[model samples]
Target: MQAFTNADMSDKGATKPGFAISAWPDTRDILARLYDLANKEPVLAIKREQMERYLGYFEHKCIKSKSMTSAAMELIPGGVQHNLAFNHPFPLAIKKAEAAYLWDVDGNRYIDFLQAGGPTVLGSNYAPVQEKVIELIRECGPVTGLFHEYELKLAEIINHYMPSVEVFRMLATGTEAVMGAIRAARTFTGKAKVIKMGGAYHGWSDQMVFGMRIPGIGALESHGIPAGCYEHTQECFPNDIEALAAMLKNNEAQGGTAAVILEPLGPESGTRPVIYEFNACVRKLCDEYGTLLIFDEVVTGFRMGLGGAQGFFGVKPDLTVFGKCVAGGYPAAGGVGGRRDVMQCFAAGLQGLKKRAMVGGTLSANPLSCAAGYFSIKAMAETDAPIKAGKAGDRLTAGLKEIIKRRDLPFVAFNHGSICHLETAAAMLMDINNPKIFTEVSERKHVMEEMGAAFTAEGIISLAGSRLYTSMADSDAVIDDALDRFDRVLGSVEKKK
Candidate 1:
């Protein structure tokens, strides 16, 4: 892979019209800082008394949430339906969301840095998009189990913004889209093996559940999944072009590789960011190896800008996986798009063809989701939501760095436009080969969980206590307020004995 240069950074860092990231993150520097923090002894953590007070907020102010979750635990596994909802102490039941805020069942408003897992770039419950969805629902209901005009509109808009996406096929979720993309790649290339960067999450599909979250620990979390499911799935460390090439070379003797799928911004939305030129290098390798490249843009589809990371990086993959902002935070928000020849493998209806990749969803491309997505993209373009959101992220990251410095903390902070990361414990950066990986991860994770609880107590909602996705609704005032809250939380941290 090519080394990053000042010119390279200048070229891609301009936040061109339609791109979300105002500046690409310094991947090498960030990684070095994170690794240093990970190797340090006596992890910086919230003081025990401070953590008790933060937990007290959950016990006292969140009484209703606790009661509701306690009752729900009897029926719902882990007391939450979604992974994102599973908080440290207990999940808070959100009653309302608007702009950059969320109101819990107890009527406590929080700065919604989670942004519905990076979908609502225009902010939570954006009025214009919500009104369009309401109008559509009132006219035709949410789903009709049949053709919808908005589906075509949504696909057309996607193609317009992403010309490389010659055709689009809507699905119900990012998982389904990944399944479809992989199947299409196999059919198109007549190969069965697939390669993904270790630690990159494509979704929860059986074949994709391998090497999740932390790299080099393949199938550690694949409890219910059988070994046969991921026999053909291979993983290589992120940004290691040589390893990827070697894997592709090895696959040639084992029926060849069908596709190389990855989250364009790196695993977990840049939690493990890639160098600016990494995607281009991957694209070249895919062409050389006769493999399809699939960009999983579930979080970056519209949030990273209308053109997404692909457009911003000037790299075109053979297939693009869409989710999250695809439906503008609406349900059933996912799809796959790519070269015309490859996408034809998913041609709907029974048409006798040499090959076909089967995929189905009752609610896929329903009227409600389509309308929501169509209007949301339009709104994002009209208001430059991605750019505005990116600016907000820049402000938040800058403020976080200042706080980390002022507090003399070892935490690292950085951002790729709207997606920001604050690495307090560096739990995710732990080396896989460490003798006490699991034990260290657990200890560091506890610290992270405590940090998340502290943020919540300070009236801020972050993803996993590390990631903060800023939206267009996050104005300078909102960011400043969040910074104040962040300052409080950071200031409360102390080295764990």
Candidate 2:
């Protein structure tokens, strides 16, 4: 892999030394290519025969997994507890995970590029973090509905890395953290409305669910939830600074905007990459509007580097949301950290003067989670795991690009450090205004699902066949092997007629 130099860093932002992302992607170039792919007729997809063969892998080779998921479907909705577990055919029952790999219940091995939905940057079931977590569990157990020393230690480490996070409060999941952040924002700013970049998922929280995955389709997936849930939640398209400014300006007449929350890298973990200067520009806008800026770093916090995205972008958000990697891939892994004044709104117990956000979780900041997070972060810093993982992402992305070019495929591949994206169908890029938008999106999505199954049959596990998260565990040899597998799947592609 190539070593990142200052020349490769984004000139528009100040990336701290040893941060994960070496080169900020050219957003205009990527968006242009994505739009072209989306607008292309007869979506290029894996051949029908090839797809059937790939599906056969689950039917024949993964009999145990199929049986297990079949039984689970009777009990669990969608046959899987998590969205990431769903696949084209069925969910595979993963029995074991180690650095860079997973073994299904059927005993089949796979190169784990999903990385537990972008949490395991040091890689799956990292031994160092696992060992510490086990030790803590054996000693004091997971949680006690009380305080733990590790909580303070973890918060200290986080503050050391992310100075913008002057105070921290742990939560059980990303959803809870997002809720807390929004409540705190409303309380601190004394404003009701919050604006999020469209298609950027802060979590499954009601307010954040507006315009999810695809921009401009507001409340399309908000079934069962009341219309009033997201009434104050407004969305603007990614990288559209002018639209965001106009929305902010408009919000002034409607009781003002409380906060502007976003994923600094762009929506869906850079699936829609943002311009290099986007974060700084948003910061300026927030400052101008007197609105709190919340950085949803659930996927980018420690994984992006210990300093987090705010540090890389050199734009300090008023609050930063943490999840996934916060507890070293352990359960109950999420938190919100920010300026002291705002975070005080989440202060536990009764307070006379200050208005509190009223956030609580019985298992939050458990001893096990805090211990695991502290150890994991220490190991990450000691080993420069983020930089190593980023190099692996760069290598994988470069290899995929080469294969795409050689095969003359209209696929687009890019990476933000360890978070790699390979858009085969551009399903998420479909325009909402098109008359047949739903039909087109569904067809393109099916193609993407087929591509995912193809990759899985080739012994690779990717996120929706489009996203792949590299880690410190993915060595040059590991990445090369995975590339060959990806090539095999891509080789079966055919333009749909």
Candidate 3:
């Protein structure tokens, strides 16, 4: 194997240091090339064949999982509760997970690259966080509906690690955190419009549903939601500062822009990476317009680092939303953090005394979750888990790229620290502004889903065949083993041809 290096990769420019927007201005061009490569006839045919073969293996080998999926379909929509659980052949009924591995009910062991959909950076079932959660549960019971010390501790730790977050408010889920962030932004700025990156997912919230995934198709998946819900919401192209500026200017004439929120690494956790200086540019824009800049870090928060992408990019947002690892992989893991003045919108008050954002949850900041989150952040810092996972990610990225290059395939693999994206579908390159985005995305959807099934069949689970989140558990040996599994899958292209 030729030792891999990202000598001419897209992430090199996407992850460049400092505030120069011109650095790596050709990122979109690099991405377009990858997309074109994946769409080639020979590559599509190979991927299609692998998808079929893998689906057959999944149906034949995973009898118990098939039966379970069938049973669950009676109650669960699409045979799974969460969208991530919906795999091509039937979702696997995982018996348990520890470190970087998962075991299905049928005794199948697989290397977990999904990482519970980008949360378990320290690895699934991380001992320290789990132990802390259990201890808290045994001691103080789960929820008190009152203040808890762990809440203060968690908030304080996050603020310490991410200085931009001067104050914080725990929430029940990423959806609620996002909703709260928007509410705070509106309350603070007294503006009615918000701008999000097209194709980025902030949550399934009614207002945020516009321009999801396929983009340009406002409220495409939101059948029940009325147009009024997203009327105040607008979308601009990812990495395109000019589009954002135009949207802001337009909104100002109607009603001033409240906030401009984004997944700082770009839509869908760097599936479409931004130019290195994009965040700083946005920061400058928001400052000029008096619009609160909110970074939806639910996926990027602790996964990127204690400070998340905001820390990595060195551009401070007025507000930040978090999820997943924020609560150490607990069931309810999310919160909002921001400057003291902006976060004051979430402060408790009497009904008529002060205007404030209405945000509260039955389980928000529960002792168990807070304890787990506090311990998780502490452990991540103590063990330098972010740096370790990032190194492992670099190794995995290099190795996967090597396989794709060696096989003469058009696939692309890149990573930003621990968060990795392997874009065989190259869906991000689709121009969301075009009316044809719907047809284009639909045409490419099958191969992408099949690619995910192929990875699962090869004992390598991924985030819908597109993304991988590496954790500290993914040491050199683990990454090597995973790369070996990936190579086997990629090598199947030769067999198919």
Candidate 4:
């Protein structure tokens, strides 16, 4: 099959494809130039000053949020439940969220760019989805510890959109889904070692967390994890086909590779992007090595398109791990889907299956989550939320690019559908092979934190101060307002320089 590219989709330049197959060259060029500009001393100083101003503003405007965060720290470690919750000054204690806006405890309002960490592609507390969820709760309740029709419906919708998924099984979180996908690959191939792209996050399972964040640092974050847990996990550079082939060849000599897994959009949701034909290249390599290719579409699944990245890229994988938008912005959103033979690993009491991965979650395929997922997919299809949100992302990207150019700032802005990334500290894309990896990350920590604070101060919420996920609710007007805020922040930083 021909490798998918921006030209494959009708809306080529308007919105980048989920897999970024065609846009890789331009993306790489821009990233290289931005990285060079960001590393300059003057640029770093200006970013530092901007961060201080925004963080100070946050401190002044969010007194109530500050108090709540302090109280939360007593009960919750780091004063936040999730990594995304802790912002620059202090995590905002949100009182309510609707559509594309959030209200903090201080009654301050901000445009919602985090999109609930990429789950709420339809927007946070989207009314139609909430209406369905509420109605389901009132009728049959949340769970029955038994079967529910919604499970079947949800599976059907997923299969409809993602044809590679001949069978499906739900899990509670993306991490569980990754663990299950890896287990299935290993079981089906009867192989040991698994190869994942460097800097790709495939959830926090002990085995899958081998190369967290920075690549080449084997199990550096494996604090309590036994060394044996990741003995078979190997890493390869993103978009480097020869490196993958070498790893697979070495693994074959070692014990054979079970699976070649990756986030289709490259590591950290395209922070480290791959070339246009990277997915197709990897697919060929996996086939040659008799290794399963698993696409961790937790962030790109439903949001990318109805067909997800696999469909967008026109390259099917042996297994697919899904999360976020898959659950329809509800809690407990994760699942594994793929060929029936391989997916049978998760089945119980099936003697015909030569191997079993033994995967199950008590809350897996629960009624409420499935219901939300089913209706969510239905809503997405009817409204074309993915395409609409992608357009919104396109507008946001264009606006940010314009802002950067106008302010003469060294930054990069781009999007894969509604998943927009604004990269300032391009230096953070650390060279995994470098011995000074820890120092590299530590030196830029303050600047990164400050950028995030500046966004928050300007009434914008983002993922880690770098990435922003737009939603279907982000209409032209909403995006324009967001652009104005972005312009303010960009201008502030540029003036400091």
Candidate 5:
């Protein structure tokens, strides 16, 4: 039909500046661009190819993310849920993970850099922790519906490490503990308002998700969350105490602001690591207002030091929520810890320890999770695992810095401990006023992801975003292995022409 139309149009002597049919060439050009967009270099096409190439390797990965998605969709809205975990590629279905390795449904092995996004500080499936869980499973059953010995032991170890946790309560996720801490703060101080640093991710709950680096201004990413809930949850810029003070003072008419929540190191995402003064000012502000402060240490806890960011920064929050290394690499563990009076609201009986906060889940403190956690903490405490990881992270971070310096790549690497945090040379890649950093993130991001994929294709696996981690299992050999891959990937991305 197009040919016939072209013939008819041609027969008309290609009527110059005349009929509607004469504009056929321009229409064809537009259609050609659209077709290119579907299969070639336009935005959608480029993004799709990236996703396809990346995810297509999953069958060889031996993990079945599809099965996980199918099972989760029965109860979750988007197969498996969580916004950050979502990627251009469908998530890989994970079947088993052990000692820095993962097995997918397709039975392929991957060196894991996700490390549960920074929780597996000691490496996945440590032998002692696994043995402890198995022993508990065989002897005491999975969950008791009553108190277990491991719970108290675990808390005792935590208290030994962090003095801020005078009293604490356990839950299943960092999200749960964060929400609980907010409730405790409000209940203890009789205040309704809270403050959070922008770009930091505390949890997924509606109340805490506001103003958290949503890639756009004043727009919250979480759906079904009531604006009324965030009306009192003020968002402040990190490292700027004045902005926080202004918001607190400005919102003073909105009722009492009970708490300020921050990461105490960096805002966790979308920004670089911060300095100590940044935290000190916020602590000073909290002290001035008589408001309780909460540190959402889901990322920094234990990974930073024995006391996590509190020990590292020497600034403590009134309440702290911990996950990640607190459970080693096991399932169903997270908790809230802080001053006694605040935690008193959650007692089980008539006293503070026994008073019910009217929230309970059969699995909130389930025994299997507690068992794994108990050993995880105990094992980390006994061995030099934390220190080992920290030292390894230092080495890896140092090597990266050397690479960047030598290659003159626009990249920077920093680490608090076993975690690798990096940012692209994009601050140098585009003009200062590029309208949208995210708009170009697709093209520029491929350079890093392809680098990562190449790293995986080599012998080591790294976090999907170029983040790396060191584990207790990591040694001079492990470090060399990862660096070989790292050298290869880094060489490609920032290689001098």
Candidate 6:
């Protein structure tokens, strides 16, 4: 074995002190063209060891993310299910996701700001929902398209809370519900065309995939999307009442418009904030023109609390599409809830069990999903979980805001209840020293890579370049822990300056 002294290694190991970076603006750009001199493969089995090593030197530690990411690519396609999870190296693989934290396979824990992208609003493996699921599964049946008590229970729960829902039905996914909402609206109004907000993501269904954002710019599709299939979904910008009004008028004149759909609070529009006046104005227009307005609440539904986003904002829509929080972080759940007149179209065919609507999923209203959803909502109401989660979101984001401000860093953050996220375009703009110069899509992407690695090292798992959600299970202590780690990792990103 060889033993080395500080002076010996310092003299021979690295370049002399005060070596300048020559003017590299971003750490990512530098990392991009650089290669390691040593074999990093040895680092793979040593993460748990590395974490211990760091903790020995300091009181805190986290995963490197690089090793875990490479491992993920071998197991899962793109290293994740959600589109935003396709970060630079690749997303870290989860060993476990419980409560408000994720443990990567490398054994590093992260405060789960991603919150399973929102379905885990109550947090992963919530006790009440889990208990209910197990109890129901053992006692009776988990799936029965014939009918189940939980489905009706689920319907009544939704009807009791949302003002717009007089009658409703459930499905297995948000896209199913959203597409059903569109189909029902057209059937009820006898119209063939629909309008959708630009940059809003309803689902992966072909019809609704039109006009999505590609690095903050609206396009028919990014890749693997057919222009012809999405042609009927006329795109309008969020919060742009004028553009909306014009589109509605033109469609009405053309006599083909049936419905208008949007994410009530879209995170994809590059943080274009929605105002009270704008939503209220939209409601008035919907009523005046007899156009059915659909609030695609996949990200907002139970997440905005018992009343969801419509009630939270004091603006009700004719039809509402829900998912995410409804399933309590489980598989198979979503639904369309709304006015009796529109829903009646779906109710038409059943005798005692008539089916008026064309939407049907073998898993639609399955007992398993219904039981999960019922328990999720009940848990929120009973524990005041939504409010608690919102507070968590507020604290986490507020801390992040303070850190950015104190560091004089540029970034934007906004929250819709417990769901919160950061947009790093401002951060990139600041780094470029000119907001105007942060124009390229590639610049924003480069920044995402840096943030992902930094957050992973800080014991926090975030989404995309800049997005996160607070779960009800995150108490103040958990929030503080994440914030402290965030503070340190951000400092590291800066030191790499």
lDDT by residue for model 2 (1-497), tens: 11222233243544458798887767777888998888865588777798888888989999999999999999999899999999988999999999999999999999999999988889899887888888888888887878899999999999999999999999989889989999999999999999998888888988888989888989999998899999999989888777788888889999999999999888999888878877777787888888999999999998888898887888899999999988888888899999999999888777887787898888898898889888988899999999999999999999999999999888999998899999989998876765667778888898899899999999999999899999999999999999999999999888554
Can you write out model 3's per-residue Cα lDDT over 109-168, one digit (the tens) per residue? 888888898878899899878877888888888988888999999999999988989999
- Clash numbers, per candidate: 0, 0, 0, 0, 19, 10
- TM-score: model 5 vs. ground truth: 0.79
Residue 275 accuracy (lDDT) in model 1: 73
lDDT of 1 by residue, 223-246 (tens): 999999999999888877777878
lDDT, model 1 = 0.90
CA lDDT of each candidate?
0.90, 0.88, 0.80, 0.81, 0.64, 0.66
Best by lDDT: 1
Comparing 2 and 6 by TM-score, which wins?
A: 2
Q: Which segments of model 3 are wrong by more than 4 Å?
A: 1-29, 38-52, 433-440, 494-497
Query: Which is superior by lDDT, 2 or 3?
Result: 2
Q: Could you give the candidate ranking by lDDT, starting with the highest?
A: 1, 2, 4, 3, 6, 5
Please, what are the lDDT tens digits per residue for candidate 6 over residues 1-497?
Answer: 11222122211111111111111122222112111101110111112343344334212332445566667668978666666566544455567878987786567767888777778877888887899999998977677567888888988888887878888788888889988999898888877678876656778787777666522333435467666666677777555677777777777767757888877654242133344345556677677677898988887777767787777656789899988767777778688989988888777355574335588888778888888988898887877777778778788878987886776544445554566656544322221222333354355455555566556655677776467777778999998988898776554433212
Give candidate 1's error at residue 296 in angstroms: 0.2
TM-score of 2: 0.96
- Tell me which of candidates 2 and 3 scores higher on TM-score: 2
For all predicted structures, in order, the TM-scores are: 0.97, 0.96, 0.92, 0.92, 0.79, 0.80
